[model samples]
Target: MPVLDLLDLPAACPPGTPWLGLDLGENTIGVAASDTSRMIASPLELIRKTKFTQDAERLIKLMNGRNVSALVIGLPMNMDGTEGPRAQSCRAFARNLDRIQPVNVAFWDERLSTSAVERFLIEDLDLSRKRRAGVVDRTAAAWILQGALDRVRDQATWV
Candidate 1:
């Protein structure tokens, strides 16, 4: 399916299936997954980007193994809320992902997600710079997915 609104996910996917979240960077793809209850998102791992096909294959394997019913991809929009080349790249990756694996995909606005993760790591977690770099992307993926889950849960009461 084409990318859907984050709010549509609850209805579009199986109730108890976990969702996969991705924070796509030029050098790496950070991965996260929600629990079956969809209440929390946790970091999974990072995929070092080599080629599109290889990356898609790895993600597909992980999603299938984890019973991921949908994907919440981070869309890095400009500060002024306009989509730039990075957003376009994310969309392209989503399209390609679905073509290979045929799963539902959604985009969440990911402004400041990385910065937020970095801050938490530096201030709260108090990790060294090298250690922080190793985990920042996956942590950011969790941040993005958590934001989407919050919005989706809020919309559930709209009846």
Candidate 2:
């Protein structure tokens, strides 16, 4: 399937299946999974970046294992709301994933996601800098996924 907008993803899935969220950084791919009801998102794991084929294989394995029906990738949009090299990279990743896997793929604006997660870790959890670095990507993935899940849930409430 072609790459889709994140808002359009919930409409494309079967009723009960959950979506996978990804924060694809240069060094790692942070992963998150929503509940079957699509109401909550939780960090799953972090996959260290390897070759493209290897990363894709690992992602596919996780998708199958978790029964993910769609993917929501965090598009690293510029703070000024413009697409940049990072956003293009994310779009390319989503396009490649869509081509290699049978599941639908989409992108969510990820501006400030990492910063927000970092703030939560420091202020709320009082995590050390090293510990925050270790888990921030996956936590940011959860933040991105939670944003999408909240929108989906809000739409459900109106219907």
Highest lDDT scorer? 1
lDDT of 1 by residue, 13-121 (tens): 9889999889999999999999999999999999999999999999999998998899999999999999999999999998887778888999999999999999999
Q: Lowest summed-lDDT stretch of 10 residues in model 1?
A: 1-10
List pairs with backbone clashes in candidate 2: none
TM-score attained by model 1: 0.97
For model 2, residues 1-159, the per-residue Cα lDDT tens digits are 657776678778888898889998999999999999988999988989989889999999999998889888899998889999989998788777767886888778899999999999999999999889889998889999999888767877898
> Model 2, which residues run further than 4 Å from truth?
none
Off by over 4 Å in 1: none
Error of 2 at 24 (Å): 1.1
| TM-score on alpha carbons, each prediction | 0.97, 0.94
RMSD of 2: 1.3
